[model samples]
Target: MKKFILDLIVKENEHINEDYFVLKLTSNDKLPHMLPGQFVEIKVENSPTTFLRRPISVNFYDKELNELWLLIQIVGNGTRKLSEVQVGDTLNLILPLGNTFSIPGDKNSRLLLVGGGVGFAPMLFLGAYLNDLGYRCDFLLGGRSEANMVQLNEFKRYGEVYTTTEDGSMGEKGYVTQHSLLQKKQFDMIYTCGPTPMMQAVASYAHKRNIACEVSLENMMACGFGTCLCCVTDTVDGNLCVCTEGPVFNITKLKWQI
Candidate 1:
């Protein structure tokens, strides 16, 4: 897919919590097609300490409104600057970067999406996409606390929403891998994005169950293109750039010990 550099107007900047915000952006031109698991690189203007653009996952896209949603976690100067932008501010972005999650051919395939922390960003878009195609999607999301879980209602609009929190402040008190939903039901495919450790656990569980699984890696990225080679990961095929080759890969291809 071709990439574009555009100044997207901030339709809204929603503060989900102290650590996270959702930026809804629109363009004078129609928004480019974006796929689940893809991301955007946003230029941080006026931030002297931040030189590189931050890579953010596509949270959700409202085609009817021509809006692109970005779920951002303010972890550094670049993101902090991004969070400060007001409604109607223009954010320059290179978007629809990286490979997307695979869509199962069988519409009847049962699917589960697992997400943790800020990694929950991409799952929403993936679920919505799958739902639109008549696939049933069940979501298992985790956070340190209830406060970390955002967009619960929005997720429910797509499928069954389940949650876990380390502090027991939400649906269940445990990691997503430990959620009882896994034991209660069997799925044909599983897709996950989150911390490496958490994803590894999910992959191991799926592997043992003979279920197909794919994980979206959150390796540190810069340039949002493959040129920087900063987000390369070892795979069965060889080292590959997460930016260009994938942010998403099947568990079987990954060199993870599981």
Candidate 2:
């Protein structure tokens, strides 16, 4: 658990009347290399109710610039206060703190990445890596509306991008699972993150087709590590900490009730 005082070098509200924000942080100290599915625990400088540092995924990183980017959505007081931070502000952070997705092998591997809402953060980095390795990838993103689909443009370079919106305000009108690729294509592997129902849906789809699938789960985390025992889940392998054991897990091992 390496700690650092990172200066909020830039902050941008990516949407209107929405909670999504892109935060860029810089530190004089050399930070650890962050993996795609890993996250960071950030301490909101002066809030009491938001006492514990919030764990947020590492959206992207720039080694040359020595910076880290986080795609945050304000869903509560902690994140709401986090959004209020301005440039030059500083926050305590412990980053690169969780397990990551496994890169797929084979040139013809049909890789499918599915995300919803702010859960798209990890996929951006995952997509970039797959693209760098000469792998073929397809991204399916779903949101309530176009405004909820953040960074869809940024991911175009990494793969063939597809979108779905409940209101038909974007690429296609329906849930991402309803996208043609999910319904028609046979992927060698599928990686997903989002709401539980959505993840469960993707997992079920992959399971039916016998495709290898992994999901990065988003749960309410306290310690952002294994010690807290806050983010626990029952799996085929028994109970595991979502914070440390996962954030990433094989879909086949997930003991889903639904």
The 0-to-1 C-alpha lDDT of every candidate, in the order given, reads 0.93, 0.83
Task: List the candidate 2 regions with Cα displacement exceeding 4 Å.
Answer: 1-17
Per candidate, the number of residue pairs that clash is 0, 0
Residue 104 displacement in candidate 1 (angstroms): 0.9
Per-residue lDDT of model 2, residues 115-221, tens digit only: 99888999898888788779989999999998888887788979989899999999889888888776677789999988889889888888888889899987877
Q: Which numbered prediction scores highest in TM-score against the true structure?
A: 1
Q: What would the TM-scores of all predictions be?
A: 0.98, 0.93
Instruction: Indicate the worst ten consecutive residues by lDDT in candidate 2.
Output: 7-16
Instruction: Report the Cα lDDT for residue 33, model 2.
Output: 80
TM-score of 2: 0.93
Count of backbone collisions within predicted model 2:
0
Q: Which residue pairs collide, candidate 2? A: none
